[model samples]
Target: MSEDENQISIAKIAKKSTPYSFTVNILAKLHRNSYLTTIHEKKSYVLGVKNIWNDHNGNHATLNIIGKAPLTPFNLDSDIFLASSEQIKNSLGLENNPEKAIHLGKIPNVDIIASPNIENFGRLFITGKSGSGKSYTVGVVIEELMKKQVPIVIIDRHGEYSSLKILEKENIPDNEDFFIKNDTEQKYLGGIIEFGDINMNPGADLGIEYLLAANVEDLIRSGSVIIINLRGLDIPVQENIVMTFCNRLYKASTLREIPPHFLFIDEAHLFAGKKKSDTVEILKLSAQEGRKFGHNLVIITQKPQLLDVIIRAQAGTWIIHKLTDLNDIKITCNSVEGLGYDADEEIQNLLPGEAIISGDLTPNYPLRVKIRKRYTVHGGAGYNVLDYITEGDTLPKSEIVEKLRRSLSHEILESASQEIISNQNLSISDLYHQIDALRQENQELKQEISDLKTNDKDKSLIPEGEMKEKIIDNLAELNSIPLEKINDKMMNLMEERDDAIINLKDFEKERNDAIFQKQSLELEMSGLKVENEGLKDILSKEKKRADDAVALAERAVAKLKKRK
Candidate 1:
């Protein structure tokens, strides 16, 4: 075949021993590209394209090739196989403008590129086991989209996206392609990428109210990325907030003329899992109808089987990394069309950064792809206790303790605040009951004190001798007592009565003060009620004025139309 021709017909293999390794005759100058594959012995072998060599004098050409493994030599036959870059590109249906396409990574050992366009926004599902570089791959995609100025909303369940603020330190010692030059200080390389973090935890600087009050659609339309951090929040609260936000976003997207926006739900299975929740329902609805409104959903989950099957089916693209679960592997195999049995085995053995990409974005087949390195700092790194202890050695013990104390105190205060808010009304009712009981007790004591005082006055009016004689006569009827002993008893009773009177007086004063405070509280409450009523009236008047203004504007527009 001539070099000018777009199509090259190469020699076919006579026999093959294995699936990945096979021999084929070099019939023409066929350069290595990902699309070149040899179907031998009822199995496919990816003919890894290495390089395209042409004669310096334009007299000859050389084709260098590689494969997944070493190949056994086979007889070269007259049978011809056709390979064409134009045919491959046409089949892939890639975008015409490279600038619009986000570069994921290069196709393995091939000149052919794999960049999905922005217009291809739809449900994208990424699944992988933990520590398999799932979040890292996601970071790469997010950075690419950010460079394109596409707005992203991430449901950060673990506070993993906060590190997007720090510049990524690429540590590929020998790979210069991954390194960023010091002179090139860009947003992707550590400069501040503008993002709003809405923390679900009450103690955080930004709370749920901020998220609710902010114009989410406007933020996205203006190309702002928002991260809703659900870390440190109860599962129920997380679910409620996620459901509400998604519902609002869907409604707003439907109402407005806006640019395409992406909603990335990390750990998506929590929201759209086996158990039913409002969040799951909202996600389902969004997955079904969101694409039409330019609202794309990117779901990242480790548990593919646990995810809602309908939502999974809605995905137009899937980036599957290393998964060990048999059920998850089966589900993945079934989801992507044209994934071979051998590919299923390969899924279990895939390296951290290696993945199999399939769906609408691929070339009508599952493609083995090496995920590109991230441009943003990876926030999902695992904790190392020893490393933390060593780092702590640099600081004074007191300072470290103070920092910990502050953190703990803030958390405690947040917990206390939430508890107080939940039970404030109940606490007021309990206080009212306690105060009422005290008032009733005080009234009973006042009556007893008054009776005691009257009795003392009656005793004082009688002659002392006559009172003594009466007490002795009463005591004598029960048991005879000496005159001196009776006198002492009478004296003790008088002293006890006086002490009771004094205590009663103190109780009365306390009761009067309580009554006065109650009266003051009542008056204050009445004034508040009146003020509230007045505010309501003002609000109604303002609403009426707004309606009238709208009516006047409508009338003016109608008159202008009539004149036209």
Candidate 2:
């Protein structure tokens, strides 16, 4: 090659601008050491790293990593994955008797425990390079739960993880239980309520309330998963519903037996926020006490930074996937260390479906595990639809349409049900097919229509402020009430009505008792008056008798005198 050509080629190669293909097997791995040294903002520290590398001349070049392992650095060499993550801790003289957890591999061919445990109760943390199966990991676990009869409640955003049909490509029983499909072939889990929609407009409130009864029922019953497909929703709404859902379930669970296993929050960072969200209290219940109550939670996310320390700390179990980001690795590992555990050295370099499981969920040792394969029916066989479509020919419309229609119908049903449950007054006017406006002017009055359309342009519109003010004034004048306080007023009115009903019943009972007493008193008074009158009549009669006797005596005396 010419000198100039060689120089240009070398420069391109150095910059990694040249495109080349290789068998790149980027694995997801973890280490408790990867999660090292955390300082509240404004704190800084150095970390030690081994086997750390960067690309140089299209070859792997090692870099100097500042790890808290405090391990002494050896001479610079290409043995990058050799520096133990623990060395840094020792260098810093921060020693603890961290029990040995499971030693995990990058990729496992079987389902094995990362930490030996009665059950994997630890928080499963998902992290990976882009397209490295971060989302796929969640789908895999969910499919497993579906098969095992363990139910889950998911706050799914982005619609990525909820696409169970992709698994059907390999035919693993994706429809044993079904989420209703929409008219557009979008399928959601049947009765698995969704919270918000990102695709629709602002006013289309995703009816979370619609799921209240069924959702609460599901929790009480247990053994059924409530998958909430929260696709196309804004960030704040996602946070609110997730936090709200978990909190509500916990509060309710305290009063009753809740569903087995807690919930899964996919893309958790959105709601985890910069710090712990207002919903942290709810999340804390599931994270800490879920297992004791037969409830468990799984939070899947590629972005670990959004998670607050409480979730990170309480998750007890962490199924950490591959995270190459230095910050992410440090935070995930150090978060574990804070819990008085000292085993972050071995699990961070895992491949797809492999993680260093930690916390109360796993054994003291990290276990290497391969997720079970999903079949088409269990949300499809955990295969990519794009790959299936690309590999095969399309079936006839007859079969295709039926399949698509079935899926879509199910999704629509699920969606509509969710909406209705969420809003008692939601205007579910109709479920008509989406259609374009009709334009049949061929044999009609085209000119008249055109003229009317052109002539009826009204530009004189009132300002929104004026319109709002008028509405407020009119409502106030009519009802002597403000719009803001309507709900409170209505509630008060209902309370008063209830009280009035109780008062009326009591009053009727008291009046009946008083009437009985009055009747008794009248009877007694009448008897007394009658007795007194009878006495007077008897005395008068006696007096008359006495007077008659006196007359008789006088007559007798006169008779005697006559005889003499």
Candidate 3:
């Protein structure tokens, strides 16, 4: 064959080996909604497809699910799915191809789609690198389940899951279920799991074992969705929570027709060791048993490759979002068989929210899924004081007046300001009232200033905040005097009273330190004096004996002289 003939053959083969997209896209008109498909570098939502066929030679070509720019008043059931690389959160980026996005209308992505017949996928295994939306995805699912009245138990190691329900209280049981751990009534609510609160002897293990058993008793019978969120836990604490929860869940699940709960483990790689830790071993058993007993386990980790081989083997579903690690992708994808994952040499090219979903949810192998927009806030878990709020900057007038009368606002604020106590001395309800008053006062002041700016009101008109301050000072001064007089004696008496108490606590600590030092010095001085007294006694006795001896010698000399 000639060199040119070889080149021609190579070109023919190259032309024939064209790449194809399996993403299902259908262009069908649904109820009167103008629709267009625009696919971009990050995200996609394919709602429905119009056609599925082979272009030629049995090569598959489906309607390429394309994305439309986010439409306002979007149809809840829009036929076309939208995709984009742009993220709802700017801080988070996709591990896969940023050029394409995955947004399937309300379809469960592979991560959450497969579980026993239930409202949710139940237990989940979230795998991703740090800051790769593992916890974020878990929180979003929990938030949804919680809205549906799911009773969630978060074994919070870093306190991330502790605040999951803070913003959703109004939608819950009298706002009681959404309690914060460090909030004023948190101890009373029993969220922290303390020994004394549970009536255990001091320093006992809080009978967590018993709590687990009892909690299972209640949940299994009730057939409620008990989401045990395990996120932000260090490796040790994570293992303990998993160990206890899995043991109890397995026991309860096997014994009852209905399983007590679903278990969600975050950073699953830390505990999913092949060496078989007791915790991991039991968890593996429970994950398998959960399928039969209606209990399910979802392991979440950034390094899915490191998860225990047996447990990963039992996973009936595969939700492959954009994974950056080649080893993780190889381990996770290869670990499971016949799951529709588009594996390639460049695995990192896939984008966020774009996942290859397969397993029980999909009929044939896996399908590419693009997640839809959520109404909940998605800025990943961090403390925002506003998220815990029920009422915005303001409250009712009656509540504010009541707050002032019950605890002196001055005393409460002073206590916090002075650091007299470690906690805010006022009730949360009281603080809310004050917050409302401040908000209302601020609003009124703002409105007044705005009016004054345009109305050219009299200069004599003082702002409400300033007016309130002046009135308070005048009233305080008047209250200090008796009989409407200057009352020098009373003024002097008050001055003495204040001087006597000026930072008594500060002085007390200092005085205590000095007293302790003085006592120690006195002890040392007494010991030294006793030693000196003993030395003096010994010297006095010796001196007495020496004098006697000298007298005796003198006597001998006198006798000799007399004889002479």
- TM-score of each predicted structure versus truth: 0.54, 0.43, 0.42
In order of listing, the candidates' clash counts read 2, 96, 48
Best candidate, lDDT-wise? 1
lDDT of 2 by residue, 1-564 (tens): 233422221100011211111111112232223321212123333222222233542332212223232222222211122222343333223223223322222224212222232244445556555555566657766655554455567766544543453334443334534322221342323223233332321211233433432345433343344555554333344555566566677766666556556577776665553454466666766777766666566777776765766666666656666777666766776775322222234434565665554455433223335554444333222122234344455211223223333444446657644543342211122112112112434425787877766655431365768868998999879797665487556545754664575497569957976897799889998998898899889888888888889999999999999999
lDDT of 3 by residue, 24-52 (tens): 22333222111123222343333222233
Evaluate residue 467 in candidate 1 and report its C-alpha lDDT on the 0 to 100 scale: 83
Candidate order by decreasing lDDT: 1, 2, 3
Residue 480 of model 1 has an lDDT of 58
How big is the positional error of residue 253 in model 1, measured in Å on the Cα after superposition? 1.1
- By TM-score, how accurate is candidate 3? 0.42
lDDT of 2: 0.47
